[model samples]
Target: MTHTITGSAKLLARVRRIKGQAAALEGSLGEGTECMAVLQQIAAIRGAVNGLMLEVLEGHIREHLGPDASAAQRAEDTEAVVAALRSYLK
Candidate 1:
């Protein structure tokens, strides 16, 4: 049930940005930033990651689970997408 991306460059770029955000969070901790500021950075990183996930999920639904696709196929894709989303949320 691996959902394939439709080669959306924008989505790829968002993922790269999320990677950088994660690194920035690590750097903030390494530099001993204030507790509040560090927590804010972490919150921002989480939001960015969620945004990337939502964008990709929307694209998967629109492209892979089209209106004409069978209910079973749509359900399978939905399950895959939800599994990925749940893992990320954790």
Candidate 2:
């Protein structure tokens, strides 16, 4: 897909950043880092993952329903996406 091609670099960068965060978390644990610090790192990783999800969802919506789509269609699509994400992330 054009969205995938166009967004590959950005998405890969995010993935790499997430990997780095995971490595840091691992290293911190090895060094006996505090629990609070580890929790913060986990929270950052969750936020990054959510951001990636948003980007992919935006691309999916754009590709499937073009900008000229009706308002009701857009609303329905958005609701479905939100519901799916909420269910998945929980």
Candidate 3:
């Protein structure tokens, strides 16, 4: 029970960090930073966002959508994950 709360806290921390990174990237651009450096920061932030998404999706699959899940539940989880991946790729 407490673990769930702690896990959510950790996730929130990551999301906040990612938001900070995005803001920093914007600030760098507005500051007339070099194009290559700005692009690198953007790529780094995008990777971090993708990594966070992957972690959350994997956690869902392992904890809530395994053999213990009902057919309907598994199907829904699968669809959600697929949609997430599709959006990530696009």
Q: Best TM-score goes to which candidate?
A: 3
Model 2 vs. true fold: TM? 0.74
C-alpha lDDT values of all predictions: 0.79, 0.87, 0.82
Q: Model 1, 1-90: lDDT tens per residue?
A: 134345566777888888888898899889998999989888988898778777767767887688977999989988987888788777
**Minimal lDDT window, size 10, model 1:** 1-10
Model 3 weakest lDDT span, ten residues long = 1-10
Off by over 4 Å in 2: 67-87
After superposing candidate 1, which stretches have Cα over 4 Å from the reference? 1-7
Please give the ranking of all candidate structures by TM-score, highest first, separated by commas: 3, 1, 2
RMSD (Å) of each candidate, 1 decimal: 2.7, 3.1, 2.5
Q: How many backbone clashes does candidate 2 have?
A: 0
Question: What TM-score should be assigned to candidate 1?
Answer: 0.77
TM-score of each: 0.77, 0.74, 0.83
Pull out the clashing pairs in model 1.
Answer: none
Instruction: Give the true-structure RMSD of model 1.
Output: 2.7
Q: Write the per-residue lDDT of candidate 3 for residues 9-82, one digit (tens) a residue.
A: 87788889899999999899889999999999999898888878877777777766878889998898789888
